[model samples]
Target: MRSTIVRIMRIAGLAAVVGAAVVAAQQAPPALVSEQELLDGLKADGSRWLTFGGDYANQRHSPLTSITPANVNRLVPQWTFQTGTLGNFETTPLLRDNVLYVTGPQNVAWAIDARTGRQIWRYRRELPPNLTACCGLVNRGFGVLGDKLFMTTLDAHLLALDMKTGAIAWDVTLEDYTRGYASTLAPLVVKGKVIVGVAGGEFGIRGFLDAYDAQTGKRAWRFHTIPGPGEPGHNTWSGDSWERGGAGLWVTGAYDPELNLLYYGTGNPGPDYHSDSREGDNLYSCSLVAIDADTGKIRWHYQFTPHDVHDWDATEVPVLADLAINGQPRKVVMFANRNGFYYTLDRTNGKLILAKPFVVTTWARQIDSDGRPHLEPNQMPDEKGEITCPDITGGTNFWPPTYDPSSHLFFVNAREVCAMFYAWKPEYKEGERFTGGAAQRVTGSNQKAIGALRAIDPVTGERRWQFEYLSPSTAGLLSTASGLIFSGDADGNLLALDSRSGTLLWRYQMGATMHGTSPITYMLDGRQHVLVPAGTTLTAWAIPAP
Candidate 1:
């Protein structure tokens, strides 16, 4: 009788503990709002825009239709605030209440009044002079939540600032910038957690996405792109290739709150030209991985380029949308991979719904039924040399693309070009840092048609329309419900195109190439205005009151 009572008491105690755990999990703070609700909120009121791409769908689409195509001709410069910096002005200004938060070179952040454009406060992050940057010194944007403005520094530090007064709340180092890891992308906030990805895939850093507690700077979790020994996908890499594998998650990702999944694109495997050292399909690299936001577990993945030989890193932002496919409404995640192929997958299950070439691609003959690319064996880089179309860059799209839900068309700026590639055995020396690969490059004869803005149908992978430019495009794009598409060019032209058809509606030259940032639209004092940070100045345009 005593033994039975003890056993029953222990079992009851265990059940109570399990019950408490279940209740605690349920009582935890509510998960972030669904992606659709976030998008709807942005479209409803143009106030309190807290994210880099305005609510994570990253459509860059605004529902405010006050500035239409008809009156866009009357647009005039409202105000321009100069940051007095020298690098590219790729900052996307975030509007909250009536204050605007922006970021620039060296991770300098400014809080200004949205209506008057007067400086409220400024947070300057002190960075090392010897910082290594693969590209120019540029930060895409910052994130706002409650009373904090979060951003990443050039030296790979994530800093949070007080929204009202520019004071540092928390400063945490993201990576060792000395080891070639730096962060330029904005910190994405989801469910009270700040999510960030590391850049420098070319500099030979293993890629991963990290989540940090919003209130405290403690790390919540990390998801490594390259698997290690005893890991589930370790077999994908061969002979210690996992040590230096390059799968950097440089860009921001999209989240689906309905399914509780975060979709992020991974970059290429390292050693750029020489893939002989790392054989087999490098799992997770050059793919779109769907991860659980709370637990950081990879739910599913779709690889765009397995064992990518070229330097085509799949670092572009994945856009989410609901579209009619085969007479059924399917939730889809669309991305134009750097390898020159546009892919659409079922956002819920990682099923490849469609895949098509968006640019001048010659390496792969076609994307097979199982969503794998059928390479033309000769197109792979050789020990001697091989001429590859769509070079290290890719077709027309490199930066973030915009989607118009009204027209169901995806707008992308692309490059029509190719390159000559030669892979050689890398010479490694002990105790000296090296990328472990050798390469020689030659420009192709048909390296022209460098820039073209194309409108594509993500459903069919068809080009609805295209706008060609004299120079290759490096800037990003934005769209609005007012039937306007905004993008910049390498020639320094900030242009507005008709959303339905790719027609040039308006253009303004800012005197320098627009690189790596998208335009934004907002309402100030009951008047809609378009804003683009060019070079070092934030320029705002509005229809002059007549």
Candidate 2:
């Protein structure tokens, strides 16, 4: 009887321990994000979105196909999340493990439940009063690795927040905001480094892209967009122009794991339209730079516009892909540039493979065989103002584009607009607008500034098909394997088009335009959800269960 009682007590103790462990497991946090998962890009399972461009290639294309062109119309709103802040979202929210990590305007961020579109934790930064952020007070997005989320502020600082609690892990200053430096792009996480760049091109701030240690906020290296005195591209900038040359990197870029290279597009030169003050090719600015990921060295660069005078920054998104061109396999970086040209460049060496106009380009007829543009007469802006096609926004701006590998097509929201550019010699002051010129949209009877969502054959630069928007759209794009391309109109309509034919598959009025943001899709609870950020609200859409 004594032995039986002892055995029963031991069994009871074991059961109690087992019960405690089960409860602990239930309360444990989700698995921390791994680098392999980020390298996986958009998986077939549609589990998570780990990066800014949905993958390092910056494809913005997904592999999920649950909602195809046929049933995309049936997508219904599951839930809506409002920022309840002053500014709209200019960010591409990151998703992992059914939780959304989103950044908003005014340095506000949140961690929300992916299944319910409910807020889990929110972060708001107390910005300085004397901010000289050139554009809107917007943050592009967040980058995550392990349990920390990295973000850049309008006050020119990079912060790593704890992924679980929205608490700041560490913060590092990128530059001083009072001196016209601000960081707006989403931090791109590669390997174990968090890569980011600064803005304030209009405020005469020299721009540089920096990589930081992911665990600590310590900066690893910085590559100045404007080359220094003894740098190889130094001669490209005559006189002291390279100091505030304004090669701002306000958009996220692509990464190639095999090459270990980060490809980023640089912004315009300072004194934007008056190139005479700072002459020469202005190396790096208005260019696409390929940098060694481990080292802050430029492997090679291709300037889309040499000595750019029209305020056209080459800050458009770069999409990397491997394609067969001229009957040969080619590794290429495709760019729909703000200079009204679409280029396919050999990614390995920064050589131009092909260049063609995707819009009404009057600045230069075409890029010559030597990779220089054939300049048109009287295209330069002057005191009297000169008219140029593509206007100041070029053919497109910073809105993210998408590429569908299966379709062999590149998609972008393009604008057909022209502007009268006026330039003058302006005095430079610290922490002030340094653009020596301005542009006015041409509203002549013959010039109608309409917009279109165009699908282009990257190999031939030929238009496959296009859907016209009443006005130029500032929305980014998203494409899926199901032959659906998601876009937004300036008139506040969310649209899904047939990727193969540009047919209108579905449409919904979101009441506010997407502006500089794009919709992201992922799987939640066995259902595919499309998250749309228009104005200040994030609305999740999914088809009702049958």
Candidate 3:
């Protein structure tokens, strides 16, 4: 019969090409978890606790083990709320279902009710009576999606509320808050878009990283980190420093959705002590790029201080795990860098598998085996003064660090201190607002005091343990598989430690000073808590037997 009807049309075209290759390998992208399946999927249910650091590999590690360390000294406090508006509260709250979103000092925003903290809706944000806060009126939190609620405005706008009636659905403005650019980190929604970035790399302003359109606030794509004519790193940058060349993608970026990329992390290159006016090797700022969240492109970049004159702004937050180096299973990313080293990379391309020097570093005398950092021609800062040694706040890490994956340990918060740079000679001015370069501190030097809480080994950077903070930690760190770690202390206490041996165990004190946001754990009804907001309040703790 015509060769059996051509063998049933080639067996129905081979079963439709094996069902479209099994739906493209089941949509690919998502296989990066494994810090013990992200602390057993944050203790398997903690109930809500949505975004910002929590569900983002930012690893503010939660897993709500119901508060351990042998009863966590019976933690108390239960509720506080405050926010009357102050300087360094540093926010970082965002539970869903029971509500709770936060954000204070000027960019204000509330929405409470995470189990009776009250205040159901606030949203202030008038700001701009002069606005030029280099380090204080913090915001660092906000971004919901689904019913809306995204923030970012120290004057750079970005709005979007209405997560059930907070109202204001769309705002947009992203920059030019008089040119000094603002938006204190925290607005990263990926997939549906919304990912923001911009924080005045010390005020020279020129970095970028927008995305918008979580349902039409517009903007779509706009990478930039300093590159202009013909792009592709624009020959690294020399004269106009690619027009102020800072890089400042400010913070918040670590999405993989199975390689859809979006890693981010770039800062420092600005006038921060004048790297001459922006000389070469400035491709993508302090570097860690990766992009392509739909098409912002990039896909690869590592930089980590290439012509950086030390204002160390790799702005932290990179995490993204899956260890097991030599025996295989890689996919890293880790980062402690603020120019004090401790990297890992190769999160699917950016390479540089490791780089040590966790601290006390005298401005790179090493870090090259591909992790490149060799600087040290007197550590730059010419014009007479140079004394760097984990100065400009480095060595002890910054902006939080935590990755426990069943104690593979990373913890962080190291600060041993050292600085005295001096790179003056800029004083520029074309239309006013310039702060590109200027440094001066060199005196009797040394001024030690160290400040510990180490515990690294993110695939062999070493330092497996230590805990000694009484003063230098600028705050931000959290961990939990129940053994605990949560940090904070420029003297305001709020400790915990003992994540398998750096000891300490419990503390509290919070009268004020816990700067950089980091501390969150949850599990509402079944019990467990830990919150920790500091300054303008939010407290929470728990465990009086749950």
Best by TM-score: 2
TM per candidate comes to 0.89, 0.94, 0.33
lDDT agreement with native, every candidate:
0.76, 0.88, 0.72
RMSD of each: 14.2, 9.7, 21.2
Candidate 2 ranges beyond 4 A from true positions: 1-28
Whose lDDT is greatest here?
A: 2
Cα error, residue 287 of model 3, in Å, equals 15
* Better candidate number, 1 or 2, judged by lDDT: 2
lDDT of 1 by residue, 1-546 (tens): 001111101111122221122222222232233334443547667754667777678777788888888877667776667676557667678876666778887676676666656665566666788777676777878866666778887888888876666667898998888777788887788877888888776666777899998889899999999988988788999998877777877688888777878899888887767888889888889899999999888889898999888878788889999999989999999898878888889999999988888887889968999989988867767666787767676764337888889899888888877776766655433212334433343454645556788898988999998888887787888888889888888778888888888899888777666677777788877888777777777777788666
Better of 1 and 2 by TM-score: 2
Error of 2 at 525 (Å): 1.4
lDDT of the structure predicted as candidate 2: 0.88
List model 2 lDDT by residue over 1-546, tens digit each. Answer: 001111101111122221122122232365788888888889634878889899999999999999998899888887777777787899999898788889989888877777766566677788888888887889999999999999999999999987777777898999878878999999999989999999888888888999999998888899999989888989988889888888899999899999999999998999898878787998889899999999989999999998888889999999999999989999999999999999999999999889999999998999999899999999899899999998998899999999999999999999999999999987789899999889999996899989999999999999999999999999999999999999999999999999999999888888899988999999888888899889888888888888
